[model samples]
Every structure is written in C-alpha cells, then in structure tokens.
Target: MKSSRSITTILLVTLFLAFFLGSASAQEPVELQWLLIKFWPEYDDPSLLVIIDGELATPGSELRIPLPADAELNAVATAESSGRLLVNDWREETTADGKRILVFSPQFPVFRVEYYTPLAINGDQRIVDFELPAGYLSTNEANIEALLPPSSKDIELDPPADEQGPTQDEVHLFQRTVGEVKDQAIRQKITYVNASGALTVPETASSSGALLQPTPPPAEETQDKTATGITGNPWILLLGVAALLLIVGGAVGLWLTRETDENEALPAASPAPKIKRKKRSASTTIRASQSNLDRYCRNCGREFGPDDRYCRYCGAKRQTVP
Candidate 1:
C-alpha cells in the first residue's frame, strides 16, 4: 500500500512540473523597435547612437538587448516610461572586432535603453555596417530604423533607394523588417559624406543632430570696418569719451580763470590812509616844571629837599640854577 502511494505522488509532481515548464516556454517574446541615429563629426569618425523602444507581452524578471560591437558600454542607461532614469543592473562583454555586447536585466515592464558606438571611416566616405543580434528567447516581431545626422548629405543605404523610408532631417531613412525573432542574419549598411569634412568636432552627438562649432567668418571679409566707431572693446570708447570730457573741462576751467582775471582786476592796494596828526601849540607842548627840579643838587644832578642845603643821595653841596 505504501509503495502504491509513493508512485501516485511521483506522477502528480511530474505532471505539475511539466505543465509549468510548458507555460513558461510558450510565453511570447516582446515586440522591439530599434531607432539608431548616426552622428558624424566634421572630422574624426562618426558616432552611432541607439534608442530602443519595446513592449513585453510577458513580463520577465530579466531582459537582454544586443548592442553594436563597438558600443560604449559605460554610456548605457535604462529609462522609465516617463523618461526618468532608473538604476541599471547591467554588465558587458567584449566581442570580436572591438565590438561589445551589453546585457541588462531590468525589473520594469516597459523600459528604454540608450548607448553609443563609434563608427569607422572607410575610404573617403564614412560607413556604418553591422548585423543585428537576436537576443530574445522567444519569437518577436521586430523592426529596425536608422536616421543619419541632418548635416549628412549624399547618403546611401544598402537596400536600394526605393526600399528606403521617407527623408527626415535632410537624410534618407533606412529601415529593415525583422519579422519574428530568429537567428536571422539581419544587416544594415549606410554610407554618407561627413558634411563638414570633419574640420570641427561636434559638441554633442544628439539624435536630432550634432551641435557643431560655428565656423568663424573669413578674416578678410570680417575685417571691414563699420560706420560707427563701435568696434573692439566698448571700454575703449568709454575711456576716449572720458578723456574728451576731461580735456573740455580743463579748457572751460582755464577760460573761466582768464575771464575772471581780465574782467575783475584785483584792487590796487591804497597806501593805508595817511594818519592825520594835528600840530601842537607851544602852550600844549610846554609842561610846568617842578620846583624840586629847579632846586636840584648840581654835583650829582639829584633833586634836593625844600630846606636842605646838601643832597642826601650824593652828600654834595646844593647849587641853584636860574
């Protein structure tokens, strides 16, 4: 009875395991659309930028996307639906011919990842040729679209001109349909002239276009002077005006000084008014003589007492002067 019970349990577990495995394998792969924009610098090789937009019918714990062999893995980022960047749990491996493979296992249902790959310049024209990898486990309907930089002119695609999509940003669009995910050898090749001949490097390899450094106007043409004296530093003009103002002010001050000297003569100093003194009469000039002075001692020229016969100061005999 125990042996029979054990056999029944084994059959039940096997059936459950089989059912789970079948359901997981049957899940449909996500639909993927890859938009790649190749930005060409005036000089140096062009850079390839990629944007991936897709929908997953079966949300899985991890996701994987194939990148170009020469991709810069450090520049990889996963973005949310609202365009906010989410933490990426990803790693990369170098492949043959300096190409790289980026693997990301994002936890989101819908996400976007962007990165760049350096392109090679072959012959005179810049070229981008690559094979798309099939990383999806299950079958998926996928499409690939490529945009050349706006400055790119004389662009040519691998799939004849008729097979190309509409022109956008002055460059023809190249698209390929990879219906149902399989190890199909999907390929893309593009050729174009680097519009500026790579004379100047691009500041940004943006999808819209590369932001180029403006070419300076020709030296000979730019040398022409304008009617207004507004060339060069404006501070120089200000300094000239200030100097003119100072010169005019000095002239005005000198003129004012000259006019003041000429119009108003300094008063000639009059000999301080002669002080008038009245002539004195004889009676006013004469003063009454003292009687003691009249009776002065002759030997010492000292005044004597009223009845003393000798001067007390010199002890000489007193003599009268008439």
Candidate 2:
C-alpha cells in the first residue's frame, strides 16, 4: 500500500506539471495581426514596386516571417505602428519554397515590418501574380490587404467580395481576413495603349473648343427682340429708368449733403496771423541787453532770472560778472 500511494503521488505531480506546462505554452503562442502587400507599376520601365507590411505577436524581441523565395528585398524597415520605422536588428536567409525567412529582433513585442522592392517584373499576359509566404497558422486569423498600381487600367482582383475596385488613384484594394488558408494569391494584369491610339492634346483641345463655341443671334433679330421687349413691357422699362434716376438723385443728394456738412464743420481759416514787425530803435535793443533776459547759467547750461543765487539744474553757485 505504501509503494502504491507513492506511485499515485508521483503520477499526480507529473500530470500537474504537464497541465501547467501546456498552459504556459498556450500563453506564449504567437499572434499575427495583418499582412499588407502593395504593387506600383512604372510605365517607362517594365518593373513594378512591391511593398509589404506585416504585424505579428512576439513575446520576445525575435520574430520570423516567411516570404516568397523570388521576392526581392530593397529596403527593410520595422516599426511599432504603421509608417513609423523603429530600431531593430534583422537578417534574411533563403529557405525552401515552403519557407523564405525574414528574421527580426525588434525593440518591442508587437512589431510591424515594411519592406519594398522596385524591380519585380510581370509574368505572361503583362500580369504580375504570385502567392504569399506560407507557414502562417490559420489560428492566428491575420488580415490581409493587397494594393495594385495605377499603370494597369484593366485590373482584376480575386475574392471580389473583399475587392475595393480601383480607387481614383488607380490602386486596387484586396482587403480581407485570412481564414483557415495556408497561402494567399494576388494576380494583376496591365492593359496598355499604343501612342497612335492614345488621346492627343490637340484632340482633347478640339473637343473642349466644341463645347465653348456659342450660337449668337443675328444683329437684326437681336435688335428686333430688344425693341419688342421694350414695347411689350413699357411699364417695366419706365420702372427701370425711374429706379436709375432715383439712384442717381439719391447719390447726388448724399454728395451735396456731405459737402455742405463738411464745409460748415470746418472753421473758416483765419488769415494766418500777420506777423508784422515794428522797426525797433537802437535804445530798445540796448535796454533789452541790460535786463536779465540775456542771462544764462554757465554751470548747468540753463537760462535763469538775474536775481538767482544758484543754478536751478546743477545747484552751482552763481557769480555776477562786473
């Protein structure tokens, strides 16, 4: 009985440890948010711009993402949010078709990685089509969005329900949630027009001119219409003339009143005071110099009365010159 009880105790402890370990693993499982792919085509060059943005859960700084083997990496950047690149340590390694890995160790647990390549050529039918990376778990339930460039006027997007058919910028959107699927495919075809078939500036200008051309009536017909309108509504013509006259009269009255008020408000300019000078005799000039009017403080540099003892400005003693 003792041995049996010991065995039972060991079994119970083992089961408990297994349960705890399983729960811990569950908690550490990765969570993927979204994968966005974008394509921009260049008319001058046959190449297209391919950009990818992916967000996933990472308990630690390390994260691994699989991409297509043929994908070209131009610039690789990571961020905590969209459009903002964060500092991270990253490297790329070629894997089998099942996995082409882009490994990153970001600063944060939740990381977004965006990278772009400008030299992806279209396959047959002038269409650039491919499947996304594999090894993504369906349980993560990640969302996906694919954008196609403007060069392709005639474009087709799969899973039409999720298709936001060509936007004004000519980019198409394939936005949807990744379900229990292992791989996602994106296909795009570009339709081109020859130079001769393309619209010319002169052609467009001619069409615009057609719209601007006006159909004017003959001078005689226009004169007859004007005469008939005036005769038919004599009262209206008179009313208009009367309104014009009233407006003119009111304007004239306003001008006259304003002028009269202005004239009345201003004081008649008095003849600028006649600064008449009387001829001064020599004796008057001699008497003026005898008075204190010519006295000035030497120390303070101010004029003062002749009886002052100290300069008012500087408090200096004043001396009378003999």
Candidate 3:
C-alpha cells in the first residue's frame, strides 16, 4: 500500500511539472528581427515612434508591448504587404509591477506604435531620456534615432551616437545602434539648446491628428523639379519663355534670309516685243505729185518732160523736165 501511494504521488508531481513547462514554453515571448525607436519633440510634448519587425510562431497571436507609464498612445498599426499601415485595435493594461503595457493582436508580422510623453525642459535647454520597453525582444540589431528641434544647437548625447548628421530637410538627427539587444531596455539621452521654440513638423501634419504616420522621403523627381524651379520659381518660367521666343525668332529670320538668297540667285526676265508701222513707196508719192508741177522752167520758159536731166534751150539741146 505504501509503495503504491508513493508511486501515485510521483506520477501526479511529474504530470504537474510537464503541464507547467508546456504552458510556459507556449507563452514564451516572440523574438523580433529588429526594433527602431525614434524620439521627436517637435510638438507641444515630446513623442516616440516604435516599429517592430518580427514573425510570430502563430499568426493572429496576442502581443504585449510595454511603454512608459505616462505614455499616451497616438497610433497602433500593422504593415501590409503593400507597405501601407492598417490601424489595429489595442488596449492598455498595467502589470502587477505597475508597468504600463499595450495589448493587441496584429494580423501581420510588422507593427508600429506611437506615443507621446512630457519632456524635461528647463528654459532654453531640453533633455530626452528614452528607453526600449522590457517586454520587447530584438535579435541582435537595435536602432535609436532622435530628431532635434528646428534652429536648435549645442547638441549632446550620452554614450554618443554612432552617427550625427543633418537630413535633406535640414533637420538634425542623432542615431545609435546596439547589438544583442534581446529583452534588455536600451536607453539613450539627448540634450540640446534652443532659444527659439520653432517646430520642425508642419502644423497641418500635427493638427490633422495623424502626427505619428511615417512621412515618406521626398522623391528624387520632386527634388529635380525643385532644383529646376519648375514648380515654384517664377524666374525659371520667365527664362524658359524668353528662350522659346528667341528660338522661334531665329527660325523665322533664317527662313526669310533663305528666301531672299533664293530670289537673288534667279535669272533676269526678258523685255516685251516692239510694235511695227506701215511704210509708203517713193514712186507712188512722186506720181501723185507730178500733175501739180509747173509746165515750163522759170529760167528759159522751156517745156519739161517727165524725166528731164537738164534744160536743152540753154545749150541748143532737147530737154524734158517734170
């Protein structure tokens, strides 16, 4: 009887341990491929954007993300295959240790979360203390980036960033990369001095209630257009118009010159023919006037024949005159 009781107790304990281990394994946190964290303070309050890319063992499984206690979630979404984010339904919960967490079931593997919290601002100086949530796990690569305010200067970072540079929009950026980030909370500190309270993000973007959406980088064609002043510069348009007018004027002038040259190379034209008039015969004119002549010569009173060479009376010779 004693042996049977001991064997039954052993069997019960083993079954209990097996069940507990199975449940724990099934509930293990999913490992992430990478986590990107961005700190932006261009609003009334500072904000953070977190993007997680990972594959779940089971699709449509529940995911729990830890955030700052004072964080107010702005947007929660999952990325589609087309790179479009579809907003997801999420709920906020608190753990026994007073840590705030967001719970959601993402339909896709990649997800995004955005939240805003207050910053530590003292006069002209601003400070940001950001850390990844302990609930998340990343493989080996993690990235943190902070966007400095417009017109800000005297930037400093704790455990200095790997890269610091200005973006095309003239916005300053500080970025850090860490390896083997798994389950550990990656923390960063950024400090900057800004006398002017100007905002880097456009007012329309913030007022439209979608400040958390990732702004796509400016297209290359758009930059080209801007550089050529095709969209905004009046001088460019004016110059283009002037150039076109010059080209048209030159073409017309060339055509006219070519026509003039062709005309000059042609042969001269011939003159018109002259009109003719009728002529009278001399014999007819003489016969018509013969009847009107005198019958005797004035010098010797001699008779003249029709074809007289000289008068014959002067020399005692016959003579005919007309």
Candidate 4:
C-alpha cells in the first residue's frame, strides 16, 4: 500500500509539470530573427550607429557571427537591413562594389557605433543593448515591426505600419534576412525591439530611395545632478573659471601694492611753497645768467624797468611774471 501511494504522488507531480509547459507551448512560439537596418548622418555623412534591445539582438562585430544552418544574412552594406535603423538629419549614400564597399569599411565612410558588447546566443534569440550618445539617433521600432513575418507578435506600438512603411512617419532601419523552415529557405522580414520598447518589422532597405531628415536624439539622461549642460563636466569647468578669476585678482592686487610702495618712497611734499628773500640790485647791475632773471623794455631798450611798471619812454612794461 505504501508503494502504491508513492507511485500516485509521482504521477500527480508529473501531471502538474506537463500542464505548465503545455500551456506555454499552446501560446505563441518565440523564434530567433536576424536582420540589418540603415541610418544616415544628421547633416553630412552622419555616423553609422546601432543600438539593440537586451532581449532581441546583438551588435554584430563581424569578428565571428553564428549563422544557423537555416539562416543567412547578406549585403549588410545596405540601409534596409535593420528595422530600427534610419536616416539621421543627413541624406543617405551607399556605394556598392563588386569586391569592395565603402559603407562598412573601418576607414573613410564607415563609422560604426556598437552597443552591448560581446553578445551570446540564448536559445534561438541573441539579445544585446546600447545607448546612442547624447547627440545621436537610431531607428523607430513601430515602423519596423510592420514588415516582419508571422510567428512573432510586435508589442508596444500604437499600431503597425504597412509593408512599404508607415506613411505618417519614416522608417529608420531596414531589416532583411533569409531563414530556413522545413528543409527550405525563405526571404522574410526581420523584427527587433527599438528604443521605444516595441517589437518592429524592418524591410530590406536600399540606399536607393530619396533621402529624408535625420531622427532627433532621445530625451537627455539627467540622472547626474552635477551636469550643467549637455556638453561639459561642471566641476572641471567651475575650477577653470575660478582659477582665471584668481589670476586676474592677484595681478590687480600686486599692481596696487607696487603703486603704494612708490608713493611712500617719493620725496616729502615740497615745504609748503617757501617765499625766498631777493638780493636787491641796481637797475644797471647784471646777475648770473642762469640764477636771476632780468627785465627789459622792448620799446625803450631800458633794463630793470620800474618794478612791475612799464617804461614811461616806451609805453612797454615788464610785469612781475613770476
């Protein structure tokens, strides 16, 4: 009887486990997807940037990508490969080559920004995430999910877009991939999550379309209380400004001190302008040329004219000029 009871308990536990997994299986099956998207610079050839969701995709570093037997990625050089990838403020340009390409090369045209480094494949899906710098932008997920195939449902979008793309808004990333199913390969739409937290369908895009405006940056991260503006470290800047003020103040103080020293070293104030006694002399007597001044009348050619009086003969007078 005890043995029978143990067997019954085992059966009951098995039943519960099976029920949980069965319900999950009845729901939608989650499949891994591979795709590429394109983005244009805001003004000139904008920097190429990529940001993936932690649960959806990984930043592909070409170091080595694991392509499943049933999956294949091609012509990543084009902009349509990513659903969340789109043009920044600048126009788009892709130069195709039989053997060489410009958009993905490390030099010149290709400037890539990768987020969520070193990715790993989890089951079928590989998840990765990253943030665009304060001034950069990435694709919108709402438009991308509209182009994806079945087997997955895109959430967090207001509504989905038509295959061509959302008419109201432009698609940022183009997603295109070839996946395998039941021994046959198929070309299909790629889906992924974007910054807006939506599963999006991306179309295999071509640099072929007319260029559009660049996407604006996301809301700034103000978690830091000390940042003054978007561009600088406030503490470093404050220090520099304070240093400059101190330098200017020090120079002024030193100049004032020197002026005070010179003033103190100067001769005593001239003795209240002394009055000197004059040596009386006859009108004809001549004194040293440099010491004493002589008065002369221009009209009469008379010397030592009446003190402060004009010569009667010449009508010319010598006043006390001093």
Candidate 1, residues 1-322: lDDT per residue as tens digits? Answer: 4434544555555555555554554323234433222332332235655555554455554554566645543233445667554545555433323334444565555545555567666656778676665434334555667655545667776753334644643554566665566555456677887645443234643432331222222234333221122332333444555555555555655666666666567776688888889977766555324444557776778877777777789988765534
Clash pairs (backbone) in predicted model 3: 304-321, 305-320, 305-321
TM-score of each: 0.42, 0.39, 0.54, 0.26
Residue pairs clashing, model 2: none
Local lDDT at 124 for model 3: 84
Ranking of all candidate structures by their TM-score, best first: 3, 1, 2, 4
**Model 4, span 1-322: residue lDDT tens:** 4434544555455555545544553312112233232222111111112322211222332211212222112222213334333332211121111111111211112222221123222343323222122111122221122222222223222222233333333434323222222222222222333333222333413222233223333235432221233222323444454555555555655666677778878998866867798956754354343224436655666765345576666676554442
Order of candidates by lDDT, top first? 3, 1, 2, 4
Best by lDDT: 3
Model 4 TM-score (2 dp): 0.26
Per residue, candidate 2 scores C-alpha lDDT tens digits across 39-69 of 4434223344455555554445355555555
Q: Give the winner by TM-score: 1 or 4.
A: 1
The best candidate by TM-score is 3
- Evaluate model 4: give its lDDT: 0.31
User: What stretches of model 4 exceed 4 Å from their correct place?
Assistant: 1-106, 117-150, 154-238, 261-268, 271-322
Error of 1 at 119 (Å): 1.6
Go through the candidates in order and give each one's C-alpha lDDT: 0.51, 0.47, 0.63, 0.31
TM-score for candidate 2? 0.39
